[model samples]
Target: MNDIFSVLPDLGNFLVGYVTLTGVCSLRLFMVMFIFPPTADGLLQGVVRNAIVVLFSSYIAYGQPIAFIQTLRGITLIEVGLREALIGVALGYAASIVFWVAEGAGTYIDDLTGYNNVQVMNPSRSEQATPTATLLMQIASVAFWALGGMTFLLGTLYESYHWWPLTSSGPSMSNVLESFVLQQTDSLMQTIAKLAAPMMFILLLIDFGFGFASKSASKLDLMTLSQPVKGAVTVLMLALFVGVFVDQVKEQITLSGLTAEMRALSGGHQGKPD
Candidate 1:
């Protein structure tokens, strides 16, 4: 009884130490997972999601050869956790941009095809989105997993510590934020344009043709007729173009560029990106 009682304090201390270490380590991870694929939407609610975060972050803390700061409690812990959270959110936002292109492309198509009025619950985005927009986003997410995107993302997170290790006073990624946001914006527009422009052009031509017919034969119900025609054509075009969209998505979520950025961050290379 004496031996068991004496060991209780030491065991409690050890558990506290592990929690502190993993808690700081998990900050960034929590931020990242909170945003993307497993916003754990729909069935994954509240405490369940948090438990998973704790579990995965615990795994991350143990799996990686992480370096710990000397005094990990009090305000220092809060600061470190905040820093990690910020970095994780930035990286998560960056990583999710590819999927946004997929979702955006669909939303654009829906807008062009007059389908944007209908909104449905999008589990992936964890918000109400148009049908086509939700479909495309879901497809892209599937492709993300099928093509090993999840692994790559987690790998980047794992390696990020090396770039801006928790103990490091300066989060070196701060300098690249502006340039990185610019890059993300440029990429988002270009990719969304590339994917949606073709469909938009087709929809515009259909609109023009219907408009011309209605103007010439002012008696006809082309306004009502236009809706059905556009809907069918939109379905057909989506089916035909979806394959191309998926193929492009295969390349978009490669995430190699993200890894490159992490490497650059670790190498102390911070400036306007090429």
Candidate 2:
């Protein structure tokens, strides 16, 4: 009885310390998983997903000393949690931009192909998307996995703790984040333009040819012919150029770029020694 009682206090303390540390470490991971793909589609409830992230993060963060709350009451805990979440969100946002660009390119192609009206709910994103858009998104997801992007992302997540420790004061990184976001947005537009350029040019040529044909034959209805003709040409062109498109996507979506972006968002500082 005496031995068990003596160990009980230590056990309780360990559990409390573990939970506290895990909660702190999990904040960033939870936010990243919440926003990033293959995990964000509401397939898992937020509470459940958060718990899984917490467990995973806790394992990764093991052996780190716990930073106990100075007070049980007040906003310090909330502030800390929010700050960690913000860091994760920043990283996830950068990662998601590649998918957004892919989808945008697909949407542009769909418009040119007269498939804009054939919209369906994208289960992955839970948004209305053209068939081509959804297909491209899936291709991006597959390529992301095949390229070892997830491993890179998880490694980056682990490194983030070294860069921005749980107990440290939040660094001023809003300006950095803003600048990165603006640069990424500009890059996204350029990427989409490049992806869709060849297809768009072909579609334009098709349109010009159809218009000339319509003018040459007054009674011929060009509207019906134009839609199907463009659709067929788009499908054929896409099949022929998919290799080029995927190669471009792979070039743009690099792990080094993502890691650099996340480091910038975290203010490029290493954690202080405990």
Candidate 3:
């Protein structure tokens, strides 16, 4: 009982740190989901799924008797607490950036593909998006989670403790804000380009085919045919690219270690990446 009393303070601190870290992650997940088109029903499903993934993994990855012993030997509970909270925020931010990149790419593709004018209500941003753009994001989010992205995320989160120790107060608001914008800009453009590549290529073929059709039928109502033709092409391209987009996002997130890296940075670590 006496020993239990002595250790209670440290244990409590660890729990606080763990919960704060995971809470930050949940918000980040929410943000990523925010830019995608989900019905209210879909959004609730996403939230619940994310909660299960986060809480279950947190216990498994961060909760261990040996880990508690390690905390006693000079690992200040405050430091551990701070680190967990900061890391959770960082991971969440990273996830947000990756999804945003996919969405940004979808936006760019819709612009170039002539689908930009067909705006629909977007639940994610509470604005509007071209059908093509919205469909792509929806597909990407589903694919990201289905392909063990969450498991990989958990592993990376665990790895973070070794690579990014929490010795600082985390990044300042200015720094985090700047990094978030800058990283989003860079990754968003790049991901969009990649996501759009296949569609863009198909569109070029489409343009040539349309031109040939017009040349062959010079007297036909070319303007009337253009809309149907373009619309058909858009639908087909979406079907083909949806799966590809998901795979690409999953690959990028896994390869870049962007989530782990970003979380470290967000938590105010000076040496962490941008």
Candidate 4:
């Protein structure tokens, strides 16, 4: 029919726009999603993950014009995709920094409490980690989901398109981007110290007390007794502080610094760390 013929061209244009946008958008999402447990790769799960990313990208990119894909050539298209992937990876790993901070703080406690002597296989990573470190990492992963972290991640991804479009013909300016990473590193160190400080201080007192007892009661074998005492103390402290610890973990997991990163990516003035 004449009416069907008239609508077909518009339908074809819409399909072309959507396919191009989905390809650009989904690569970044795939990189980000794989960094989380729920979306990690398994044969069946990978397929589902792919479907979800494509759908979400399509949903988000629905109104955007993707005619820019027509302007890209072989090398240029590959360059754009590589840049998009790197951006996704960089953004994805930002989530893991909080996990690392939690694990680091726990490992430091392991050193203080003499628990580093024992290593446990982490089910998620399949690597041996000190018991406390393994525990904290698991806890951080839980807090990531329970505290709406996925929302923040997706929000950052959505906002990213505002600055770094598929049409970007060049790379993000390095000078603007440099300070963003430095600031994140500084924040990571500061967070580690903050989380570990209280436990460190208490454990130091126990060590000091044990040192004095060793001198005063030389025959008592306080060295044998001290490890158990420290273990008990660590357990008690962990129980008492875990609620607050989760709260702190919640703070670090947010991609709140992303707005600044977006501005920097676009060669705009970078904002200070949030």
Candidate 5:
């Protein structure tokens, strides 16, 4: 009886520590799952996704000492939760950037191919997008899975704990994060321009030829004829270069790139001690 009574305080402390660590870890993962393209935008799906992430985080966090504040309530807990959420969102945005860039490339091609008028509802995003954009988004999703991006994503999340542990205060490098975001945005635009260049060039040539023919023979509706021709050329170009585009996406959205971005967001900070 004495032993049991004496051990109660220690046991209670252990349980509290375990729960705190798991909750903090789970909070971060919940934000990631909430913002990640594959898991976000669905209420039930988000819940299920967060559950899975929390499970994985729990496994990773097992036997780890609780390095966070002991109290689950108060200003510290609130601050910690907010910090974790920010980290998760930053990581999720980094992961989703590739798909956004691919979609932008497709949108640019649509503008070149006279397909901008053919807009359809995107089920995933609840926004209207050109058919080409929708198709590219779908293809990007498939390529993301085929290229082992899911594995990379999970690994990155796991490794993030090492760089910015749950116990750590908020990220330190605000200027670095701002710069990284600006750089990524610029890179995304450049990538889209590159991807759409071939189609744009071909379509421009077709338009110029049609314009010349129209000036030569005013009675002929060259403008009307140019639309179908441009569309056909776009289809052909896509058929020929789809493999190249997928490979490029796979190369750019790599594990190393994601890890580097995460490290930058976290300021390469080590985990905090209890």
Candidate 6:
């Protein structure tokens, strides 16, 4: 009984470390699904891909046997423990914000097209969303993964451990909260604008076209006929731009340098000293 009690701390630390890493990876994948438009190629490989991703992420966290052993040290338990969980949530939500651009844009489009009443049950979040919005979300998710979003996320997590190690001396709770809010608020709006800008531009053209058609055909009951026309245009535009959008997303993810930026943010905390 004495021996068991002595080892309990070590055991608890190891388990917590492992679970924290796993959960962070899972949350990353979840956020990607929520935010980005998925590519059609990924539709069939959905669950399998996520499983593989998590497995790979585990390797990233514990691949160093020595580090894994070090993480089992009973010191810094309380602080590191809480930090890991909060960081996981923060990273996950960041990804979600980026994805939400597609969701918000889709919602706006549906409302404009008179499809707001139709709802789709999204299995990912187990929530109801507009069908067009849901579809765009899925596509964005696929695009996120297809463009190596998992790699970027995992890289960010790894960088966190290296740059933001848990320390007995760290930032205050108020400081953490203030910095997090300020950082997220600044970036969230920018990310959403970047993702939605293209779609909104296209939609503006769509609106203009409809307006012109309506004016030219005064006797054709344009209001009633415009719905189908807009829907068709929306569908057509989405289909035509799917490939182009995916490529653009890939470029954006690369250019954004999310992994490096994440490291910088993590370092801002009482990270591990090199």
Candidate with top TM-score is 2
Segments in model 2 whose C-alpha atoms lie over 4 Å from true places: 2-10, 42-52, 67-73, 251-256, 265-267, 271-274
lDDT by residue (1-274, candidate 6, tens digit) is 9999999998998777677656543443444433333312235256765675576657655554446435533554444555555655555555455556667767877777778899988655657899878887777776666667756666665565555543324445466657876887777677656655666676667677767887898777666766787788778877976676566666444324666665555555553332
Clash counts per candidate, in order, are: 0, 0, 5, 0, 0, 14
lDDT of 1 at 221: 69
Candidate 1 C-alpha lDDT tens digits along 196-264? 888889888989999999999999968677767778988898798778777766755756567776566
Return the lDDT, model 2, position 85: 81
User: Could you estimate the TM-score for every candidate?
Assistant: 0.85, 0.86, 0.58, 0.79, 0.85, 0.65
How does residue 265 of candidate 4 score in lDDT?
52
Q: Tell me the lDDT of model 6 at 247.
A: 69
The RMSD of every model to the true structure, in order and in angstroms, is 4.0, 2.9, 7.1, 5.0, 3.2, 6.2
Candidate no. 4 TM-score: 0.79
Candidate 4 C-alpha error for residue 32, in Å = 2.0
| Candidate 4: regions farther than 4 A off | 1-21, 36-45, 60-66, 169-173, 254-274
Model 2 is weakest, by summed lDDT over 10 consecutive residues, at 65-74
Clashing pairs in 5: none
User: Which pairs of residues collide in model 4?
Assistant: none
lDDT of 6 at 11: 90
Candidate achieving the largest lDDT: 2
* Model 5 spans > 4 angstroms off: 1-21, 42-44, 60-63, 67-69, 170-173, 254-256, 264-267, 271-274
Query: By summed lDDT, which 10 consecutive residues of candidate 3 come out lowest?
Result: 32-41
Clash count (model 6, backbone only): 14
> What digit string (tens of lDDT, one per residue) describes model 4 on residues 1-274?
9999999998897777567657876888889777753344521266788888888887656655445645445776677677778777767766567777888899999998888989998765666899888888877777766777777777888777666655554444364347657866887788888889999999899888988989998888787777789899999988887788877556666656655655565565332211
Superior by lDDT: candidate 1 or candidate 6: 1
Which of candidates 4 and 5 reaches a greater lDDT? 5
| Cα lDDT over the full model 4 | 0.72
Question: In model 5, what is the error at residue 119, expressed in angstroms?
Answer: 1.7
